[model samples]
Each structure stands twice: as C-alpha cells, then as structure tokens.
Target: MIGKQLKPNFIFEASWEVCNKVGGIYTVLSSRAQTLLKEYGNKLIFLGPDVWQGKNNPDFIEDKKLLKNWREAAAKEGVNVRIGRWQVEGKPIAVLVDFQPFFEQRNSIYRTVWQNFGVQSDKAYGDYDEASMFSYAAARFVEIIYLSLIHKNKKVVYQAHEWMAGLGMLHLCKAAPSIATIFTTHATSIGRSITSNNKQLYKYFHGYNGDQMAEELHMDAKHSVEKQSAHFADCFTTVSTFTDKECAQLLEKSADVILPNGFDNAIVPKGSAFTAKRKAARKNLLRVASALLSEELFDSTMIVSTSGRNDFRCKGFDVFLQAMANLNSELQRQSTENCKTSVLALIEVPCWMKEPRKDLQQRLAEKEIPNTALPNPYLTHELYNEGEDAILNTMRSLSLMNDRNNPVKVILLPCYLDGEDGIINKPYYEVLLANDLCIYPSYYEPWGYTPLEACAFKIPCITTDLSGFGQWVDATLKHRGMIENGVEVLHRNDDNYFDVAQNICNTTIKVLNANKTIRNKMRKNAAALADKAQWNNFIKYYYQAYNFALSKKLK
Candidate 1:
C-alpha cells in the first residue's frame, strides 16, 4: 500500500518537525500530506529525526523485519544504516536515529558547557543537548534513508528543510550522489541575528537579555549551517518569492527555483454563508480584549493585535510596537473635534521549542559564545484550549489597566492557537471583523501566508512591498483603488519606524473612511487573488520538483 505508485516518483524528506513541528513547515507538510498520499503514495518515503520513545505512552515497535531488510540492503550498498522510530499515533514510520544518547546527557552537556563558560544553563543557554542530538540523529537518519531508497533500486527526490535536515541531505549524498536534493530554508539565522543584535531595546523589554544570550548560543554556527545547506543541495527552494531572493543573498548560494509555500484552502474561512467563521473570529477577539481589559494592561480605545511564533525581533513585533507608540502620538495631536482615537497593539508570539544541535554548536563555537534559551510556558499545550486560561488571565491583566472607554487598545498575544477555540486562532477573519486594519511588516518572511489569508477574509491588511504576497497582490490589482489608500503596501527597509508609523496611520485613516461598496470590492479582489494560490495548482509545482530530480535535470 505504501510503495505502489502509478508513476515512479518519490520524495525523501528529512526534518526535525515533519512528524512533530515547531514552525510553518508543519502547516506546509501537513497540507500536502493527503495529496502526496493520493498522488505519490507508493513512492513517498518520509524520513525524520529518530527521537526516542523510551517509556512514553503507546510504544512504537519498529518493524524489525522491514528494518532488517533495509539494513541488509544498506550493508550490501556499503552505507551505514541507523534505523529506529519514535511512537507517533501508535505506528512506526521509520524515524532514523535514536536521540536518547543526546537527550539523556543534555543536562550534563549544559552544565559542562555553561559552567565552563562561567554561565548558568537557564540564563545563558537553551536546550543545547536537544539541538546537537537532533543534528546527529538527523544526519544518521538520512544515511539510513540513502541506503533504503538508493540501494533498493528506487529513484528518489530528497528534500531537506532548514539547516537541521539540510545537513542530513548532504550526508545522504555521500552514499547516493544521484539522489536529487531540494533544500528549503524557512528563515535565515543571520538575518534574524541582525535584528536581535542591532536592537538592544528588544531584549530589554521582552524579558530576554540578548548580549549574554548571544554569547552562550553561538550565532556564528547558525550562519555556517545555512551556508553549508545552500552549498550542498543541487537545488534550493525557499518558502516565498521574496525569501528566495533574500536567501540567495543571505546564504550566498543561488536557489535553483523559488517554491512559495502553499496553504490548504479548505482550512481557510470562505463564503459569506460561513457565519460560523465570522462568529468564531469575532468571539476570539472579544475574548482576548475582554481578558486584557480585566487585567488592567491598558486603557486605550483602538485595539491592534498581531500573532505569530514568538521570535519578536524578526517578526517585526518591535516595529509594530514602535508604530503603535507613534500612532498614539499622532492620535494625541488630533483635537477633540477632529475625532480622537486611542490604540493598543497586542503582539503575539509562540516560542520555538525544538532546536537542531549541530548548527547550534557550530554557531556557539564559531562565535566563542556560550548561552542557552528557555522553552515557552505554553509549549506543552499547543492548542488554544489547553492554554486558554493562561491567555484569558493575561488578557484580564491588560483589561484591568486599560480603559474600555479609550478609542483604541493595543495588545500582543504570544500564544499558539487553533480553530477549535473559535476565536484566538482566527487571525484575519477576526482582525477584519473587529478592528479597522491588521499589520504584518515582516523583516524576512518566506512567502507570507498571513497577507493572503487576510485578503481572503476581506480584511484590508498592510504588508511590506518587500513581501512576495504584497508584490503579487499589488501587481495583480494594479492599485486601481480596489483597496483603500490606507490599505497601501510599503517597502520595509525604505523607511524608519517614524515613516513606517506615518504610513500605517495614514492607511488606517484612509481605510476607515473608505466607502462601503469600494471596501467590498477590495474584499472581492483579495479573495480572487487568494484563489490563484489553491493547493491544486501548487501541488503540480511540487510534482515538477520531484520529476526534475528524477530525470537528473539541473533546473
């Protein structure tokens, strides 16, 4: 059932988060999974890092016979096979390396490294052992996959995600040089570091001490892994058209093709008849605002919010904060007769949990820095309900301080939310329904999904001209006044925080004043634009990636 494809095509993917994820890669892979199963079921072999099951619930017993056959084949092909599996949903999917060696010794490694460097583990370093073990285990897993597919007489296309799995693909090439490899980086380490290092103010407020943290975590190896990944892959792919160009320059390796990540349209809110979607969005915002009001965080009137994984520096949370502060100043300039609006922008970011170690160590060592990062408080429960109480409690704090009578309220929600909650996770739909506008000024986004999502919801969103989606939407619509003048797109680096704030304020003013019919037209235009990115069309591109690799074509 697993290997009988109508066409002889296969995708060998290595990732830290395919089976379990920490970022957007999970959404991309999950969206494509059913389709891959439908089109390339027999040929698709997903190879992931082999995290140990240990005494965890529902033990996953690897198919020893199948594994033995794989190992025997690898031995014949002169490739080392490291085969194992972590228990996921009670079945084994052939995860490659046993990570227990690294996991078990993590505390010791942390103690040794941090203590040697005269730093504490919690304060200076973060999951150092987990990252290191992930790389080692991932590399070994790819070696096993190289033997399984290549030695077994299968033509395959190997796609590695980020630096973690990028190394794995490189390791695989040592054993199977003919395997076509695709490397995709969701974000670059250097680009992010620039923001973190340049802005000391960010670490100061966010409860993270940047200078000390940087010294312990080795930012240098992060750059090295990125460069190595770019150099080794036959072809490179990034999540967005904008990111494709950004990555080539940042990593100094040209991408063969730019594959903008696609989303599952079915999961998106659609159609006017989708009242439940509308309700879900509205309720979520109200719940969040209510919580903040209860907590006494602010007394502002205009409530502005942004959500994402809690990497504040790169996601432009600081920009949003500064913009809101600017908006506040501008609002104050208005006379009582000119219409005053008070605003509070809430920035939400979910912390990254799992990290790849090889790059981590390499980075720390190269910089001669020693540091560790902390896991998020809500890491254990990804869904909104699991962390609902905490979220409400956080909101309650904000609400108690902020006046409900104020013109605007701004808040930052740094949590992982889902659809089941009917509110917090409904980003675009909710933001469109409640507020006048949403801000997504990403410093480096690989094919941003939010802008398109907001457009689909009929929300007038402000994205940077540097974004792939912004460029695409602006180009397609030709700015024919379909969207509000305030619904304008600005280039990120072209302006400082002041200029950025002015543009945002001006756009908000424009959209808030736009005629009803015109606003409706913009919504239609957004939905039309989103239709172009349907999964059906995007799947073909993926198929082509596999086909090109199979045919041994460079492009």
Candidate 2:
C-alpha cells in the first residue's frame, strides 16, 4: 500500500535548492510556499540541504539531534544521514543530511563513479551523489514520519523537485509502496548539460569536467532515478507545458499534468507610480555604466536589460550582447543624425561558484577570444583552441568595450533579492522600468520567466520562438502581430547572427520610436497579459494532479 501520512492534507516537499540557496527552484519554493501553507497548513513539510547554518542557530540544535538519530538508525542499513532545518522567510524547512559527509569524504561517491565508468559529455549528468543525498534524506524523513505515526496513521502526498529529490521519492515509494508521490522537474540535467558541455562551458559549477570526466562518474544512476520518479509517481507535473514534453521524452514516460510556474505579484510593486522608482533606478544604472565606460552619458539614452544566472551562450545573453554591439558599431559608422540614440545594456548574471583550480583555467581561456569571433559560423568554437579563445575574448570584451552608437553596459548582480533592498538596487525590475527592451534569447528554456516579468511592468521584451513564453505569445497573438508592440519573438535558427542582431536592433528601435499613443495601448495590453497569468490558475493543475495521484493510490 502507498504509505499514508498520519495527518490530513500533508505535503512532503524535497528540493536540492530549498532552504539552501541555489537556482530558480528557490524562487518557486519561496513564492509558492504561502499557497501550499494556506492549503495544507502545518502539515506541509519542506526538505532541502541546509548549506548555510552555524552552531549557535536554533535550527542547528534541532538538526544536530535529527542528524544524530538518523545517523545512528541508518548505520544498521550501511548508510549515513545528515540532517538540519532553518527558516527562510519564516518557513519551516528541513536541511536533510549534513554536507560535512560529502565534503569530508572529498565526494568519494563521485570518485567511485569515475573509477567505474569513463567520463560522459554532460558534466551535470555524471554526478552520482546528488541523487544519493536526495534519496537518503528523503528516506530518513519518511522513516521519521513513519515512526511518528506508529500509533495513528495519516496520509502524505510526497512531491519531489528535479532528480536530486527524485532519489528520496524513489526510496520512500519502495519503503511504502502505496503512498502517493508527485515529481516536478524544474529543468532537466541532460538538456542543460548537453548545452554546457558541447559548448565547453563550465563556469557555473566548480570542478565540473566536460563529458569525459562525467562519463567516469555514474550519470546513469541519476538518469535512472529521474526515470523511476516519473514511472513511480502517482502523478507527474512540470513547470511548463514545453518542459512537460521534454521530461516525458527524457524519462520515456507520459506526464500527468502541466502546472506552470508563477511569481508572486506582491513582490512587484503596483501601478505606473512605480515609474518614479524606475526613473531613479535608471539614473543609478547610468552612473554605474558611465563609471564602467569612463564616459558620461550624452543625448537620448535607451537602457536595455536582461538578468539570470550567467549561461550566456544558452540564455541568449551572447546574442543580445552581439546585437547591441552590432547596433553600436552601425550607429558609429552612420552620420551624426543617424546615430541619434545611445543604448546601454545592464546585464546581471548571478554566478554561484568562486574561481579556483581547473574552473579558473576554463574561465581564463574563455576570456581570450574576441567578441567578433563568436558570431562567425566558420570560426565557431568547435576546435578546442577556438572555443577557449572565444571565451577569453568575450571576457576581455565584457571588461573593456564601449560603443558610440549604443554603449552597451553590462552588470553582473547577485541573484538573491529581497524587497527591503532598494528597488533601484535590484537588477531586473529596476532596469526594466528605465530600459526600452528586455532580451531573452534562450536556446533551451522550458518556460521563460523574465519575459513575463517584463510584460508585467509594461516593458517591451524580446524572447526567442523556442521558449514556452514565446510560443504562448504566438498562440495569443495570432491576429495581433506584436501584442500591442510591447513584446516580440525571434526565431533562433531563422538566419545568421547578423540577421538576428539586426532583428533585435530593429525591434527595439521600433518600440522606442513609436508615438506615445501606441505606447499607452501596449501598456494596457501588457497589464492584461500579466493579469491572465495568475498563480491560482497554475496551482489548480497541481491540485488536480495530486487528486489524481491520491485516487490512484487508493485504488
């Protein structure tokens, strides 16, 4: 029988990036936690790695006790258990299994995996312990719950995020065959790993080797973990419809439903009055840009912005940079009259890892290549030297390039943002208010959140046709080509870099040059779009998936 939680309306959530900060998963849990809490009350238990707690914290106390108990119990089963908890925005979350084991052992799990097999092409795929930690923590938590309910049994709907958490779900399922389970893969390792490794980019993760080293590690185990989570879960849900399709294909199983990710509108300030805040933000951006370029802003300036973790090649940051560079170059070549506009791009990419060892070598190599070489089909980074050169030049160009036509200024800001921080200091929305257009040229986005954020602020945005947001725009704007001229979609493979760059330039120019009458119409349409994308609509699907899973378990 599917093991039941001993309580009513309980949710057991496990994510690698929960209480510990990581990627977009943290955003999802933070924003969506309220909804879950409202629905399930005290019964919802969030689990993740507690990466940032210390000895004096109250959470450390509970974690030490929990970890001690679990470690003692699991010794009989030849496994280790590290556990902890902390409050993020006042949410009770479990940091499962201490990281000391993995760190102290020098990630022996990875060593063993490497010893067994050759490296694989995808670095993200090869890590074996990510899933093991997930499974261990999950099983430990389940064991705790099971023990708690020895006298009075309750039911739980265990939902796991990505492959890391999938391990826990798998162990839980095996231990209690009849308990309902749900799996949500915010993004897949295979697709992203392919993009990173094939391109030879590994700055995001420290000590990540391209496919060869990955092949040596046990990638298959994690793949199996993900596949089994799909196969075993009573219902499977993904962040976007496109992601759902990708996961089904990857897992070789059909998904039960699509529960698209949503942001808390509360985080975003309301009305155009936020306009004054934006203007101030723009002024601050100009100051930073001016300092970087060692020049003051003169004449009409248009700010363009994009924000995310830095995976420039895949995220289309490279494309946007190229477009801005090309536009600046063209404007410089033109007569003074033609070069009336100045553009600055404020880019904030949150990089997680510190520079060290092999990671440093890769970073330095990427900095050696010139920006001009990246767009050349013939000069693409296929050869090792070419790739290394391209990366180096990009870095050099990032540090020391300013254009006369449009001086594209890039900013690398932190990913973690809270409201108390001045709105002007927050990279994304601050730039959106002052900027003319936001660019997202993703090659493999399941759902693009930035575009939606841009739309919410009534700012024009450019996203590629491959993104789920772009597809939605296509469907929504069958008759209306430009959606009030606030957002535009570009095809990634439509033409060469020159053509793509020109399109981005032309689109941004068109939006900015349009009269006030057109701009007002666009803002109205933009707000309407944001209103339609409420979290309630998205969460309904999740509820339905849970209901379906519960019914299956009962049967």
Candidate 3:
C-alpha cells in the first residue's frame, strides 16, 4: 500500500512555455494549471520568460495588482518582471521575467556554471544562450521571492520543465538548498537530436553514450545542463514510463516518479453544446473542402486528420502520406462501383508558410461552391520554399493528385488554426471536434498531445506504440488495435515503415466501414479513456513527486 504523501505549502513551476504557446509543453502546463490552482491557490506561481513584452499575448492577462509588492522588490533588485494571470480555466498567477540584461554577463555566468556544475557552455550554439539566460533570470526571480515572502519553515517545491529550464533547477539547488527542486524532462535534448538525425535510437540505445551522442549532434551544452539537472535535483521526474526509460539510458538517471501529462476535461463541450459545436465543425470543414476542391461533398463524408509539429520523419508524415496513397489507390478502385465513401484527410501541421493561397481564398469567397478545381488544390497556404516543402514533395512523390473523382482527398493547411488561418478560421479544438478520426504515428513523440486532445473530443485516433500516450493506452487496455477501444496503437519501429503504413490503411478502412452504433461506442470509449487521464486523477503523481522532493529537505 502507498504511504501518506506530504503536500507542498507552495509550488513554483517554471517552463519556457508558461505564457508562450509553442508546443506540447504548453498544452501540458496550461491544461493542468486549473487543477494545481485549486489545490495550491495563490501559492502556485508560474515563472516564464518575458518574450511578449511589447506584444499582446492572448493567453495572458496582465494585472499589476496581483503581486505588486514582489514586483516592486524585484525591480529594486535589477530584475524586470510582468505579473499576470494566465488566461486559462483557473487564471493562476504568472511571472514573466525579462532575461535580456543577463546576456551582458553571459560569459562570466557560463564560467561559473562550468566551475560549479561542470555544465559545458563552450560549444553551445543556437538558442542555448537565450534559454540559459532566461533560466538564470527565472532562478533569480524564484530566489528573490523565496527570500522576501515565504518563511523558511514552509515546504516549498520548485519544479522546472524541459531542458530550457534546467539551468534554473541547478541554480535553485545551490542558492536555496532548503527549497525542494524537481526537474521534469519532457524530452531529452540528445535523445531528440539522435532520432531527428535519423539514427536508430531504440536499436542502439545501450551502445550510444549520451555525451558522445551530444557532441556528435552538437548538443553538448544543452545535454550537459539537462543531465546534471536530472542527477542533482531532489526529485527527477518524466511525463511517461517510456520517457522514464529514455531518461535512464540517455540522461543516466532514472525518474523517481512518472508524472504523465493529463488534460482538464472541463474544457471539452458536453450535451447539446457538444452536438451543436461538432455539427458546426463538420459543416465548416466540409464547406472549406468543397470550396477548395470545387466538388460537392455529401453529409456522409468522413474527416480524418494528422496534426502536430512539422517533424516530417519523427511525426511520421512520410508514413501518413504513404498510407493515404495506399488508401487512395484502394478507394479509387472502389470508386468505379459507385461507392460514395468520401475521406477528406487534412494535414493540419504548421510549416514555414508565407500566406494563405489567394486562389483558395477567392474560391472560398465565391457565393456558390464551384465545380471547377483551383490550381494546386492540395495546399491551402503558399509556402516560402515550395520545392523544399516536405509535405508537398511527398505528395508529389506519391502522385497524390487531389482529383475531384478520387474518393480520398488531401489538403495541407500549413498554418496554425488559432481561429484565423484565413481559410477554416477555427480554433484547433473546435476543428478537432468535427473529425471522425485523427492519426499521429510519431517515431519520436515524448507524450503526444494531438492524440490526447483527439481522445478528449471523443474522436477515435490512430497512434504508434512508440509515443508516450500510445504506451499509456496499451497499459490501460489489455489489447490495442481494436477500434472499439477508441485508439489503434500501430506497431512502429526503425524497419517497419511500410508495415505501419499498411496497418494505418487497414485501420482507416475499418473505421470508415464501421456502423454508427459501433462508431458511437468507440467515441464513448475514447472519451472514457481520456476521462481517466484527467488532471484530478493524474495530479496525485505530482503530489507524489513533491512529497519525495520535500522528504529530501528533512534529510
């Protein structure tokens, strides 16, 4: 039986994506903020970089009165900060620190870091300087707050997320040893580099040295800080068991607790609102597809999508296209028999886009859906480098002509769907509710938020066992690959690209062929699985990590 856990009196969480929405870490932090707020209330403070100083950040609501005293104190200490409440469910307090001043002293700071923690910054490149300076600023902010506000007797837990905030964790470990520090690595720097470089990460995991790989991948500085933070933190944690294993092998430290990323289901619409929103989503999606293709689509049409960061190989875009081509071939063959099965597959991954295609926009503006197709109807946006664009190149290679006669149509919406992408103009979640299925066959996903979000919307999805969320699904359900379970975890590995593609095609056919009763049951099951992953249930693991970290203070 598990023992009673010690709760933290105050929790200071730091991440690069506190108010800045970038990737999956933003979803993890933002979605779970409400649950943390309910438990810790005003004591739960979030620290993020002040990247949105002059600009308007829609996700943050600035309030000068929130932490007026601390802000005044911080200003006197040469620390610039903006105190606000993150515009989410709980509206928790957020402190955005400006780290620009620290860049002037970066050289000396790096030398001191090297002297104390042996973190090598000599070969650092790219965003290393910016991230490190921001991390140092966050650490300074935390130290100042701890010294001014909180009593020494109070239990404090300082949790840092990802390699971007690793340096802050290290700083807190030394500056305020009494505060329990917890380092959570969503994905290791070296591990991602290894996979992105097309190296077979899983096969040669035991043989590859983290330091050697980091040097080879030119990620020495980031890896050094991340590994050291993992080793030195009072409690080291990861988002999933799969990542826990990766941390052990790559970062050379096993996690004390697995803090699986969870969602707040309250954001999802329910009852009549859900039905109406889903209808609107489907209507808008079909209308846009019809306008782009100049083909009238029936109400029986199916919308399937794959969305995430534009990591072509890692996110399995190659396999997604291959499977779509295969499905297209099968559908084209079946089209001769007057089959009305229409599958509109949307690639909602953001890319380096210049602007929305003017021709597509004009077509959308037309009062009636034309029967004539626009040139290059496969793409919704005009890319900066069309020839080098991976999605377009792959579509060309596969000869995936967005033909009006073909049953399977593909459209690339190469921009973020923050309700103003000029085409579908709907928030991602609103668009997600319209889909019948979502696919994310990632080869190196840490914890896939795309599939989790899909499940939350009661949409059955296909993901690979390689993803952290897919592994969780496998553990939750005795078996996978059945559509009834709401998720089909396709087996993916270094050598099984074609096999995975075939599996995806087969699963798509099965889902499309499934009756309404079966599909409804699958949708219900998907939401049920996602309900099990709500923050209310998963936040206990965080409490567990805090207990472990605070227990270290007693030692």
Top of the candidates by TM-score? 3
Write candidate 3's Cα lDDT for 370-447 as tens digits: 778888878888899989998999999998878755788988989999998888899999999999989898999888
Error of 1 at 82 (Å): 14
User: Candidate 2: misplaced stretches above 4 Å?
Assistant: 1-8, 55-127, 150-153, 199-218, 271-273, 298-300, 333-341, 352-392, 395-400, 403-433, 478-485, 494-498
| C-alpha RMSD by candidate, in order | 12.2, 9.0, 1.4
The 10 consecutive residues of candidate 3 with the worst lDDT sum are: 332-341
Model 3 vs. true fold: TM = 0.98
Best to worst by lDDT, what's the order? 3, 2, 1
Candidate 2 per-residue lDDT over residues 1-555, each given as its tens digit: 113323336677777776655566776776676666667755666776645445343333355664455456554544444454445433554545554444344345334433433211133433455545554555555666555442234566788888777755765666676567898876666546656544432223223432333244345555655666677787887777776666655556667877777655656666666877777777766654443343465425777777765676667766776676666565567545634336666665554413212322232244232233112211111223433443335634744244333334444333334322222244455556776667887766767788887777777778877677777777667733363556677776524556766788777666656777886787667666665665655666667777777777667
Which model scores highest in lDDT? 3
lDDT of 1 at 115: 38
What lDDT tens digits, residue by residue, belong to model 1 across residues 1-555?
213222344566666775564666655675666556666653565565545344432223455665576566555544333444433321334445455555665466435433332223343224433544565455554455565544556566778877666534655555567667777787765556655556432223334333333444465444454566576666676766666655655666656666666655565545664556555555545444443343222222344456555555456665665565555555546536533334545555554323222332233234232233212311222334434444334444434223433344554344344333222545333445544356777665656666666655555677776566676666756763224532356766624655765677676656555677876666566666667766666776666555545555333
Please give the distance, in angstroms, between residue 110's alpha carbon in candidate 3 and its true position after superposition. 0.9
Which of candidates 1 and 3 reaches a greater lDDT? Answer: 3
Question: Which residue segments of model 1 deviate by more than 4 Å?
Answer: 1-8, 49-97, 102-132, 145-152, 199-218, 270-273, 291-304, 328-345, 351-401, 419-436, 478-482, 485-487, 551-555
